[model samples]
Target: MYRKKSKAFYERMLKKYPDVMSIPQMSKACDVSSKTGYKLVREGRIDSLKIGRNLFVPKEYLISYLLIRDENNVR
Candidate 1:
């Protein structure tokens, strides 16, 4: 059986590495497309810190948001 990652799993990763997360990393972690992630950042659904032309999202916040949204799915 395939096991999906939990919020705690991501929390641990964040604790281990506080550095900025790249778009590909975020996409894999949140199981979203890079485009979607960018859209979320633009819409303020997800928080991001920009450095130069790059953007980074806090792992904790991203994981939490994904968990909450998954749990609240209307369908």
Candidate 2:
């Protein structure tokens, strides 16, 4: 399914690029709703930075999140 491929692609991109990503992009990459991404940021679950009205999650943070989730089979 699309989720599988998207997740894999994003994982690959995150590992290779190590760049910051917007909330929407992070949501799509993680296959979650933007609201959830925002909640993660707002709740301090996922660390992010604000820049000119946009929130950006660093690739390292995302990768760590994914790796932890994957390890626990939570995502």
Candidate 3:
């Protein structure tokens, strides 16, 4: 017999492997556009690192930022 996975399992997986994402991946996951993601970086609302002209967002920071914004709307 096959078993079904639970929402909690996916949540835990996301939390455990947040770093396994890119800007496009994040845009899709967060329901935002790539342009908006770039704007957020430029506005200093989110943390990012530059490697020659490429920008990388830390997964933990992204997750925490979204969670804080959702909880307190501080941004």
Candidate 4:
């Protein structure tokens, strides 16, 4: 049930973004400052992949974070 919504949401996201995104791209997609995006990673609110000097955010992680925030009513 919810999985279908998640998949559908991800499909829509794919139209606007890549499967894996950099911090800046994630920040832009989430409508937050890049600093906040980095903070989310640091605080473990968001999962990330660190490769050398770069950070990558998988689109699934974005959906998870959004769903959590929605469930908790967090801003």
Candidate 5:
């Protein structure tokens, strides 16, 4: 479960990504493996969209994942 952080917190990712994007695309952008991306989605670490058997991720959720990960690593 992710919280609704400040809008500015997500501004960077929101600018780099579309409102929604496929896992493959997001993975490429993040320079991670598609498997890792899928894992994140499946594990519920990143919110996702299941549309007609295809999984998509919203930019906001991706931003949430990135921000959270960055915050954790900075500690």
Candidate 6:
């Protein structure tokens, strides 16, 4: 299914990329709109670090967010 494929893709990405990711990269990985990603960053709903002109999200934060979201959906 899509969830399994997405999870596998992320696992591959984690092995290939660094612990931090740019907004665009995060958006693509989560299959979310870039605007939503920016909003999440601005609202502090998801943890991010602003490095000069680019915003970075930690891998840990992304994993936690997905896990929490999955749990909420289950409930």
TM-score of each: 0.65, 0.69, 0.67, 0.82, 0.75, 0.71
The C-alpha RMSD in Å for every predicted model, in order, reads: 4.1, 4.9, 7.7, 4.0, 5.4, 3.9
For residue 5, give model 1's deviation from the true position in Å: 9.3
Clash pairs detected, candidate 5:
none
How much is 34 displaced in model 6, in angstroms?
A: 0.9
Model 2 misses residue 57 by how many Å?
A: 0.7
Q: Find the candidate with the highest TM-score and give its number.
A: 4
Q: How many clashes in candidate 2?
A: 0
Taking the tens digit of each residue's C-alpha lDDT, what string does model 4 give over 1-75? 233245466458656899899999999998999999999999999999999999999998887887787666677
lDDT of 1 by residue, 1-75 (tens): 444557776677566555557766776665679897788888987778888999888776677676666566611
**lDDT tens per residue, model 5, 27-67:** 88677899999998999988999999999998878877877
For residues 1-75, write the lDDT of model 3, one tens digit per residue.
334444454456467445746666666666789998888878987788887778887776676666656556453
lDDT of 1: 0.71
The reply for model 3, stretches above 4 Å from the true place, is 1-20
Query: Whose lDDT is greatest here?
Result: 4
Q: By TM-score, is 1 or 5 better?
A: 5
Clashes of each: 0, 0, 0, 0, 0, 0
Model 4 scores a TM of 0.82
| Residue 48 C-alpha lDDT in model 3 | 84
Point out the higher-scoring one by TM-score: 5 or 6. Answer: 5
In candidate 4, stretches whose alpha carbon ends up further than 4 angstroms from where it belongs are 1-7, 10-14
What's the lDDT for residue 19 in model 6? 79
Off by over 4 Å in 6: 1-17
Q: Where in model 2 is the C-alpha error above 4 Å?
A: 1-18
- Range of the 10 consecutive residues with the lowest summed lDDT in candidate 5: 1-10
RMSD of 5: 5.4
